[model samples]
Target: MGNQQSIKIFLALMLSTAYIFSFSHFGALAYNTLFKNTDAFAAGTAIGHLDISEKTAAEAERLLEEEVEKWKAKTKITFSYKEKKAEADTALYEFYIEETLRTLKQGQKNLAAVDVDQEVLEEMIYRTSISLGTVEIDTKKLAADLLIGATMLDESGYTFHLENYIPEAVRKSETISKATVNAEGSLNEIKALLKKMGTVEIPAKAQFSFLRLVEEKDIQMHHSSALSIMGTAIYQAILPTNFSIIERYISNALPSYAKLGYEAKVDEKKQMDLVFSNLNDSAYSLQLSLKGNKLEAILKGQPFLNKYSIVKKDEQSFTPKTVKQYNARLESGETQVIESGKTGLLVKMVRKIFGESGELMKTEIISEDFYAPVHKVVVHSPVEPVQVTEQAETGAEEGEEEEQETPDSTTDENVPMPVPGAHSESEDGTEVDEEDNEGDEKGTEPQTSDNTGQGTDMPAGEEK
Candidate 1:
């Protein structure tokens, strides 16, 4: 009985062990199949704001396409310039879907768990998705198309014109400031250009360009020099004669009334321009004219400010010093004046604003202008006067010696001999022939007949 009981116990123990082994093997196979066949995300799989988990590649692509299409439809781009406006559809912009998919695939490869640690796996599951990149616009092509449209609009005269809206009843405001500068010399050419410039009506709050107002064709440029003689000193001033006159006239004309205006120097090569803004609310007309020797620029508009005054203070004066230069072209002991000395000026220009009741409102410094001084130059020749005098004396002595060596009469066969009794003394102490004297007095041919009325070959003073 004891032996049978021990055999049963042994058989039960073996069966229990086999059952446990079979169950463990089946559980491991099922777990591996779940990881391989399920469509759920492995770990750390994301793209932008998209939840791509538990989705096939085809499903994710479809969702992303739909989302991008909606975004493109809603997006609108517009460009504006003044009153002109342009619009462009977002569909014209290029978007890269394949490139985005490739990036997402790369992110997926990084999440593979072949040799990943527990910490790494946790990080991958919690990390944010990668970007799908941005849509790109063909800006060069867009600009070309927009430019064509803008050109068409301009040709159609759709652009705004400022001249049609000028306000009437323009009145002269208080003389903000009056600048009286004598035109250095005769500015006839500049006066002609100013006359051609006519009058320009500037719109309210508009800016003005001086170069544009006056074209190169309007002014005739001539080669001229600025010559000034002060006492015994003479100055040959070199400057851009054509542009200098224009610059000086404009410089004197502008910023007279208001201190807030700007000054610009235009350069064609450098692509720079001169511009000034009219800060007043009413339209202003600028008229330039030449009165006598003065260049006058008048600003006409309704008075924006009640009273304005400009104060100019002398800051410093620079006196030119005399400089001596040696000249090889001049004779010795001779001095030529090249330039007359000029004084430089540093002047502070200030604008004073006053209230209607005669109270000063404010004083502002407009500019600190500096005028460069021209130095006095005296040119002296190095050649000595004694050397020139000696040369003249030597030349005179050589001429006298040559004259003494030459004979008064020629002995050559071709030379004609002097006729006897052909010479006669005139009242003026000059030697003259009788025939020539008679011809001169009567203004006719001399007669050949003598007292005997016989034609003879003897000379005029000889009696036949």
Candidate 2:
């Protein structure tokens, strides 16, 4: 009897609990129906952190649109790989608003769509990649995360990294720039060096060294002076392109075989070197060939994106002074040029890079050279050393007085006078007739005839 009574008590308590739960649920539903507008968004309807509680569908749509536009205006995505970077801003934002709103109105929750052209976005990023370089990007995740994580309105702009650079293998390419120098040296030795260097392959971003390429035995056999000619040719070839000069030194006296400002002076024992860096990320070749007396240096690789030109400007010249030495062996007023003077030169060479549309991109000074001058030398005897003294002057005057007392009556060739019956060409190309008897005495009167008729042989002073 006691066990049956305990079971009946438990049943009664269960019935009471069910009745209370039902009453509370019905009460809450009636309250919502009476207080809330049926056409409005249910409680806790939100899009992009904007509260849409108790707001009409049209009002919620306007607010969400404004929020989206605001986020887009403030949103910018930076996708980078190594040093290359690409950016996309408001253009990447084309959210699907109606679909999101319909789901939310049907008591379901969904995120707005941040749809974009994956092909176009990927192209934009990959364009910055170099010829022997590549990058990787995830367009799907990049598009969805903007709205899924609700980070669209985040003030700190998004910066996503694409894959690290994957470099491609390099090979020999066409010649981009070249230079040649005619040097006076042994052709066989230079040919040997060129043969050893052959087609030098320079790795991307490698520092170039002229002496490093040649062997120690070769350096000892052939002099640095001859090697400098080759270095100068290589230097000139590099100036017209976008290569960085690392270390270069000039000779105290400019060599006869090297270019003015482009000479790369090298002495193996002295540790002088011609060093430069290939700052670009592409491999190149230095093709050396002998053409007669010229050493040709050609840079073979892909062409630089921009055009490069070497311009020589800002020239200054210093005149050498004349040095004279007196020579007792030379006669007075005699001169001989023992040395020909040369004028000094101060010149600069610059590299100018231009864009495809003819816009100046950059300018760099390659070299500034100063060649010393050798002064002019001459040997001459002064006139004062061989001048007439007082005694010689008095004797010279007495001799002059004696000559004046005995002046001759010879016709002075210096005096201007007409000759008798001088030969002349006739109008018809025949020689005019001349008289035979010739008397050339200075005091004799000139003979003349009356104008009547006998033409004496010829009139003395008339054109025949």
Count of steric clashes across candidates, in order = 2, 0
User: What local distance difference test score does each model get?
Assistant: 0.40, 0.62
Spell out the clash pairs found in candidate 1: 235-339, 332-383
Off by over 4 Å in 1: 1-196, 215-274, 327-334, 380-464
lDDT by residue for model 2 (407-449), tens = 2222121112224323322223333222211121111211122
Most TM-score-accurate candidate: 2
Single out the weakest 10-residue window by summed lDDT for candidate 2: 436-445
| Model 1, CA-based lDDT | 0.40
Among the numbered candidates, top lDDT falls to: 2
Residue pairs in clash, model 2: none
- Model 1 scores worst on lDDT over the 10 consecutive residues at 227-236
lDDT of 1 by residue, 39-80 (tens): 445455655445566566677668666755665465444532
Candidate 1 residue 269 Cα shift, in angstroms, is 7.4
